[model samples]
Target: MGARAALRHGAARIERWLEIEREQLVLWLPVMLGAGITAWFVLPDAARWIGFVLGSLALALAAMVLPGGGRAPRALAIAGLALAAGCALIWWRAERVAAPVLARPALAVFAGRVERVEQLPARDMVRVTLSPIGHADLPPRVRVNLARADAPAGLTRGAVIKLRARLMPPPAAAVPGAYDFARVAWFSRLGATGKGFAPVEVVMPGVAPGADLRARLSGHIQSRIAGSGGGIASALATGDQGAITEEDSEAIRRSGLAHLLSVSGLHVTAVTAAAMLLVLRLLALSPTLALRWRLPLAAAGAGALAAVGYTLLTGAEVPTIRSCVAALLVLLALSLGREAITLRLVAAGAFIVLLLWPESLAGPSFQLSFAAVTAIVALHESPRVRGWFRRREEGRGRRLLRGLGSLLLTGIAVELALMPIGLFHFHKAGIYGALANIVAIPLTTFVIMPLEALALALDMVGIGAPVWWLTARALDLLLWLAHITASAPGAVAALPAMPGGAYALIVAGGLWVALWRTRVRWGGLAPFAVGLGWALVTPAPDLLVTGDGRHLAIRTADGAMALLRDRAGDYTRSMLGENSGAEEELALLSEAPDARCSPDLCLVEVRSGARRWRVLATRSGYMVPWAEMIALCKATDVVVSDRRLPPGCIPRWLRLDRDTLAKTGGVAITFADARIRAVRGGGSHPWLTPLTVQPPFAARPEGGGRATR
Candidate 1:
């Protein structure tokens, strides 16, 4: 009887839990549905948020009037519905504001407070944001991409400056056929972006020297924290990533430890947990305050302090804000004795982010942050899986092992989750990424970050002695680790361009697997398989030809390519990834000889040796005889010149040098395959004439060729 009762009790508990989860899911159905629909029919040239708002309001009314017996459900429904509509509406407004700014030939003049600066050393680009100046139509901030290669000029927040610039639209999605730009301008609510900047006079109005104290304090803290043994400290404490070089960034990214740099849920959760432990320890020392109420009070205080400090340090970005909200929600739930950390929290936080700053949904930060948190929470809640690491204890050995395991798990999970995204956005993946992350992540979390924080504090107090020593040591250690990791063989792998839908499917499948504990482990497999297949099978042009044969690029089956330049235009070749740089498409083209062409319209008739070949340059041009060059042309392959042709003969296509063509058009006869050959008697080097060509001998079964630049 006792054993039977225990089994029954266990079954009862599971049923109850499922019931609760079902209720929660029902409550959020409207929200998820609304967000899904809004994201689906998004338009480029038209405002899309209007439909989203109408749909959300309609859903809310339906929920309110539904035949259910609960005030709580109705309230939840109202909140969820509002959040959904709000997110879409905000995105719409942001895009509307940014559209005019991004239009070509559009110029805007405004004055605003400087908010922040982001410098990308690898891309040699810098972005600056400014608070709005005058018009409501103008964005709350503007981003400028530097057009020149000048050494970094420091700009701090609160500095009022004016400028004249042309706005360029944010990049559109290039997902083959999808709405380009991912509707980012809509999601982020950004006003405008520009390619250049000419700073107007800094209107220096006499103000208190310490008016902008937070920036000063953060900067001081960064200096001190950087004194420690790792790059992690400086990153954790302050958002200044300029210290992380390109090589270091690449190593960290490859190793999947790049998440350590972003001050998102992980960073915030760590700080919160640490603060709570400290506070609980303090209360335990008092004995009298070890009560449950006291615990709640301590948690609240510690969590709030940590949230504020971290947010301030990180510049209150969208990812940081979302993390802060999650932390706050978790703390509140603990205080209120609520055991639910379901999709509700995730949805709520997402809704808030989109409602407040909808554009964040389009950014990698927002996606990565939520992805990590959602995966972790779902994994933690799974009843079937045992704890991967034991609860924290005082044993130093145990602590170290646990830390290492956590690092490994986090790296693997995040990288796996983001692999498709990285490939789609970057066209490359780091083979050495996991190894790099293993080495770098723990070092940052434990030793380097703490020292950097300490250094920054010391610097604030004007005590430069010990902090400088720490900072130097930390920098050397980080640089060494990065250099070694980056040098590993197969450290980087290049891939062909990935289609946008492939990324979408992969991301969706990954999320489903990570965020829900269904028997859907195989759910992610389909997208992964599809993405890989698409990448391998997509058709790309095999050859790129120029009219003069001076410039060329070829593509291979694996989507790698190479270029060959007749003259020293290294920049052009580099752009094509023909030289030492990594351009997958151009790299493949460099390996074929039979596919290559010589100067003029010459076809290598036969190979005499590695260095010599029998070549023929067809005097290819267009002709107009009998008003058509068909009978003989159709019977066999014929090349003609427009000038030599009587009356009007129309060949399939005409080929001519830049100077020879009578009409200039956008299409450049780049690379030609065997299907095209030069016309006879067009001219030795035809200029100022139309040229005709016939397909190369497709049936000749020519051997493969390689071209080099």
Candidate 2:
């Protein structure tokens, strides 16, 4: 009886906590979605749509059957249901875009409309995105590299053209655990990418699908404005970064103003707010309209319309749509004269963006933009901040000072809040971002954005040259400011790679603390500490293997990563050099201080602690005797070859070749106390299958049988 009473008391405590959280529970939907996706990627099974559906159904059943005797049980069940919902949504999305993949490079000849065109700066060629002919004939969409001499001087969108191109599968991850190009390509609905050899045919001509408004707007701006001014104008107006040069992009990044380059929340919010205020002033000037009708409502509606126009004029990506949605919600609240709720508005935006593109959960733009905005909203809308701002508005002079202070505060909050995420994805963070914003944001907000908008407006009437010139002058100043600020000490700092699950956990903990309005929210710091600890203590991999198994690299005692080969394929060399993320050089990894090497083969001994293991690396020529191969395998612990070994080779020896490397994408070997273990570079992604291995063979069972003892 005493134990039962104790249990009841504990249950009551949990119930009260749940009640405290109920008001803000909806905002946790993204957290649930992120958890589900993380689980999907980490799970060691080949998940199909049928499995996801069944799993969702099972979860739904469990939720329905769960006892309602306690609030704790109900809350747990709801969490399960949310996870199931996310799984079902992602599975459905993946199935809709799945396409047949090409296994080898072949000359594919197909005639289709060109949807997008980008000029290759280094080569005198144009890269074109061709529409899919059929779901089965080729990939859903193909990017063809066309030599400029064989085609028209300029190829705009929607030009029907026939070309011969060497087509291959969309590339997989460039390095083990690096960016997954294949997954991104799948989500983007691109099936193949290649270079066109001979392209000399044009069947028809029309405007591009997305270029109807952007093309006309960009062309007018370029014609009216020249040089970097026109380039910046075109980028801001039409969401084209290709017009900006590499040096300008680098300058912007170093200055901590790369956010300005993208059409995101800041640009959208500023443009819509400015348009609304202008409309409101005009409405206020009409005495009869202002007194007789709801001028505020009219202005709000006009603002929403402006936002829609801006969305269409610029690139309507996931982050841009999310900002538009948030702004519209705020306008709706104001028009109705209802109190605005920040959490609900953010929740709605997140729901809509995730519903449209679930894969965006993995992108830096969505995470950083949302995190910053959410943190700012939480800070500015808090009671203490509201009271302070109200006090600051006591006089006209104070109001100006308050506005400047608020801007500075906002920049600080956003930069600090987004620091961990930037570090996780880019392995770098800007220390002087807040200071940079002080000089950058005002120029952009007051002078640059307004002037660019006016320039576009004037271009519609063919009188844009004067305004374009002013805009160019402002842009030059902005560039000069960027160059100065970015050159400051500690402007940007580099970070090492994080451990498994560190990024997800850190983000989730931040959300937990930000979404709740109680002092108990401090508990979120525990998970954050755990993630940071993982990042600090986790040792990087010792050995790097390529997807093709032809090249290998390892970290040496002298602290520079060393490669096994002096020369390798471009992809292999790049992946190894980049993925190591440490001080690296092109020096070869040799077993002995002085090693013997021939054109076809090289022998090296790798020393780890008290243990030593031999490694045999060779180029093509499987025609070598099976006995010689067996002896080489017996003498070495690892065998990396350019081509596949003969069927008679021993399976017990650890080996990687052209035939078996794709299974794991790559592997990282770790040696501790002379015992070696391997960790996979590629995780569970739909584009590349989940990797599984114990050692000697990672090939299909039928192929492994040939080398079995």
Candidate 3:
């Protein structure tokens, strides 16, 4: 009797909770779609087709039974259908964008017409996208980088150029769970990336009106405002970031002001609002038209047009497109006298974007942009918040103070919402981002952008120099703030790679908290806290080996990382450092007191609690004698080399050589409980090379190797 009563009570509680959330069900549609898309991306290639077929069948079954079922069944059916549609959408998108990827690295002479040219002023190089004229094997588009000196003079869009170049396929992730450059390049239709050799020549030059305009505008802006400030202004005006110095870019990113350059919601909203206000004022001057016409509707239409124009002018990136769509929806809402900002509006924008570009779901820009907007909207829409910020008759000083307080609170909420995302993608989060944004957002939106527009308008009469000077000074101040904030102690909190499960937990919990208005929403805090705790307690990998077998990072007993080579490039060093969660510079392994080195290889011993790992890694391309190799392998627990090893040269635990690394891509190793575990990266995704078949490893015979008890 007691058990029956408890069961009945639990069932009743769950039923009540579901009833409360019933009204918010519609808001979960985009979340379900994103889940399905994420599923497609993470599943193995072979499993994707099977999963899609199963989902389709489920959808069909649900549709057939939906009409005859009760409310619960109908809701389940709708959710199932949405998930299936998401899977189908992503699969279709991937197939539609499929292009031939370069299979191998090569050096050859090729002629092609330049489709686009991007200047890299900081690096003194130019990157041009080309349409190969005669290379049937090459994909439709390829991007090549050339030194300014080697590039032909007057290289522009539509100019045909010939050059000898070293070309390679798009690169894969540096390690498992890192950024996948190949996936990005695949979606972008770039078949190969290369650097040009000398003897570059231009075959012909053709005119491109739009490219010329953009180039002229960027050049004009840069010439007027000197230094990195001009680069920023050009980015804002022309969507060309090539002129921005790398140092400034880093500082801006660290300060959380990088969004200013992205030309998203803030910029789009500003442009639309300005256009609407201008039209309203102009129409008001003509009293006859103002009285006869639907002036607000006309203004809305004008604002929509301006939003579209600005989006196109800014290259229509994913975030820009999302902002444009949302801005248009807002205008539509105003014209209909309906609420302009709501969760439904955000959902609609996300739904449209996902339908058009499913691949973007995997990119950080899409995730961060939508997440930020959703969080802000949810925060401001809370009943308590609305009542607090409600307009009341007050003194100017009090009103101004309230406004500043609102801004600060909004900034803090956004930073908190974006923290997990930033850490997942970048391995670091800006601690002072909220404080930095409080000043930077208003400065960029009101002061710098207005000055820039006025200067551009005055340039028609060549009297823009003074206005341009003011713009530059304002930009200089913004830059100064970014530098100061970024350079502050503890400004950046760097972490090791976050596990996918933890990230998923945080995102799901965050959505639950944001989407629900009921007291039940507080339950979400449980999962969010759990995920943060999981991330905090996770251990960094003890060993990191690059996919190419050219670099290795080993964490010693002191919790300091040492590199195999001191001459590793900055990118390689940084990646390794981030992955290992190293806070200081990495020392060369050969220089470490415990490491023994020779011309051919370096040997190091690492201790993990009661167990010790012996590692031998090749340092050069020189081939060691087969007998010596076997002897060396016998003494080590793991062996790493850039060259292929013979079948008999197996280590006690693992062997990673050219052949294996070609298959695994990269490997991260961890040690615990007297055992070693290795995580390798390689998938059958379209962007990755087709993996070669190899026989599985057999355990060593008894007495063939020493045992570590």
Candidate 4:
């Protein structure tokens, strides 16, 4: 009785404290997000520890400053602070330990079994995780980022291989003002990466001949599951991304339904829930089974089996495991007759995940997965959206409509929930992502799975081409859909990446406001505002050039425009578009001339006067003489020449070489001082060195600035 009273008293006191300082808490959110962003930069390979420590320190300080006179409030504050601090410290320590280990380059002959394999399309690379054979000194698992060299020949599960190659830390963020790749990789629990190897030298331990039988059996099961349904069943049964095409991916991204592609938490839950329902239905049908306890046990068993199968189909990604574990917890709690699900289960799931794969916290899958979970929980509890889902399960049409509505709602919710991190890391979003998901989700889930399963089964039977053809058709259809949707108006948007400080605060604030139901939620808004301000007020580009610089980019209040050059091919055309050729990039430059991709040439409109013919100078071509083409020059007021003018224009051009001519032309441009530079070169400039020649156009000492123009 005394212990219960003390606990109640403590809770009441903490609630009062939160109620009193809710506003201040909101102001702290930006600080936390800023910390998270900074942590990414400082320990890009894995810096969760730093954020953890800092957050803990802040909480401790707040606890110390609390004016409460009661023992319960003071103790509660200290506990909360300690928890935050511990999380931060753990993040920092994990990163420090992993960075050097991953970065060391050496030829390691570690024997290990294949844990998982993933294919990356952007880099055309394949990554595999290996469980070290007997090396106790190293982490239990290490990730090998290798090219798919000869993998098609034969590489199967449980095959122990001796890999030989130079292993180094994962690649860091290569592009400037981009995501912190180092941190991202760290969160992925990747110890090291390697490339460049020959399969001939690598030894693969032989497996028993019967091992092939098991592979065949698994293949058969996977095939049947994949072929069972068109889109939905395929997604549910096997996490075969091959069933999804580029177009469907785009549509899903645009529709904000991309989560439906991989067998993430939702899919896992769906599978589990379906299994549980089936088990319960079976129990109800059997007159011999009257005990409620038996039903829970049966459901638990079914859920575990389904979870394991789903994981195998999806390659058992970290996110899948997290979801599985969390679902298992909920089921267990239910079996124990718990009246309600507590956040403890979710917390436990997080703890187990971090303990198992400490690095996963940095990966998108981890963040996105957890973000979806947190948002769902928060939204479900929200005063407005609360009970909305539970109240609408009547009628067939309503169920279907509600299902669709729920998916749409989920997409929007997840996207909005993850907005700060998404913007900070990617600086853009597929505008039409939400719509794409609605169609792709159903199709991939029901149709593609069945096709893929059929193909795999047929392959086992030595006649898989028919199934393969069907799968191919499914892929083709998806690709076509994504292509069409991606081409649609406002299909994508690009913005500046969020600054570190603002990003951290946003993240912190979001956690406080979104997760905690206390008055501290109000404090989250401040950081959110700060983050938005930074994103919305992005810095303008350093230079803007109209196509090929023959026509200057017109600067406007909202943005600047570089009228594209008509004389350039696709490569140069894209470069002139500020290194972006995606839908959003093209849409932003809508006023520019249409860009045509062709076999030999790509033409874009140069904003220069139509009468003034402009050609980007190549090694073989020089500026055309204006006098010779008086007809063409009639409407042209001025000729912006990039080629060297005759020696008469320089007065000292008696012995001119390519260098002198190039220097003279480069300096005579008003936009040089601006960020834009005009490059007119071709082939290799082997002779060029770190040397410069003063051009005649150099400004005199008395002038305000250089008079290159």
Which is the leading candidate under lDDT? Answer: 3
Q: What TM-score would each prediction reach against the true structure?
A: 0.65, 0.84, 0.92, 0.60
Candidate 4: residue 7 lDDT (0-100): 73
Q: Return whichever of 2 and 4 wins on lDDT.
A: 2
Off by over 4 Å in 1: 1-91, 94-99, 102-200, 206-234, 277-296, 339-344, 387-410, 518-532, 535-559, 563-709
Tens digit per residue, CA lDDT, model 1, 1-709: 9998996686666555545545444424434543443363333222344555566677677767765335444654665575555556644545354423333224555566667655443355556676757645455656766532531233545566665555544433211221234145434444466654544435543234344444445444444444222334446665556546555776666545567788887677777776787787777876667754567667667877888777776778888888888788888888777874766687778767766665555566777777766666655566643366657556888788777776666566656666655556555556656557677655665666566556655755778658667656765676666667656767655544445566666665665565445454557778767866776564333333333333444443343455543442644454334211243334422244543443323232122124222222222332224523433233222222223333232333443333332232111211233332221113221111212111122231244211111
lDDT by candidate, in order shown: 0.52, 0.69, 0.82, 0.51
Per-residue CA lDDT of model 4 for 509-603, tens digit only, reads 66767666656578888987887787667453322332222322222223343332334454333333332212223222224343332322122
- Give the local distance difference test score of model 2: 0.69
lDDT (10s digit) by residue, model 2, range 1-709 = 9998997787788778878878777777666765666556555454553475467557756756765555556555666676776666776676677765555566555677788776433244567888855335566577777665655643678787775666777776534455566778877777777776553467777564445667666766666666555666677766666556656765677677878877877788888888889998998998999899887788888889988888877868777898899889989998777776487798889878877888788778888888888988887877777777765327788888887788788888888678877766665667778778887888888898899888778877888779878998998887877778767777765444555588766776777778887777788888877886776665655566666666777665554566666666655654565555552334565542434456566666556678665667675453566788777777777777767776655433467666766565656665543323333433444565411111121222221111100
Better of 1 and 3 by TM-score: 3
Which candidate comes out best when scored by TM-score?
3
- How do all the candidates rank in terms of TM-score, highest first? 3, 2, 1, 4
Q: What is the Å distance of residue 636 in model 2 from its true position? A: 5.0
> Model 3: runs farther than 4 Å from truth?
1-23, 52-71, 208-211, 673-682, 689-709
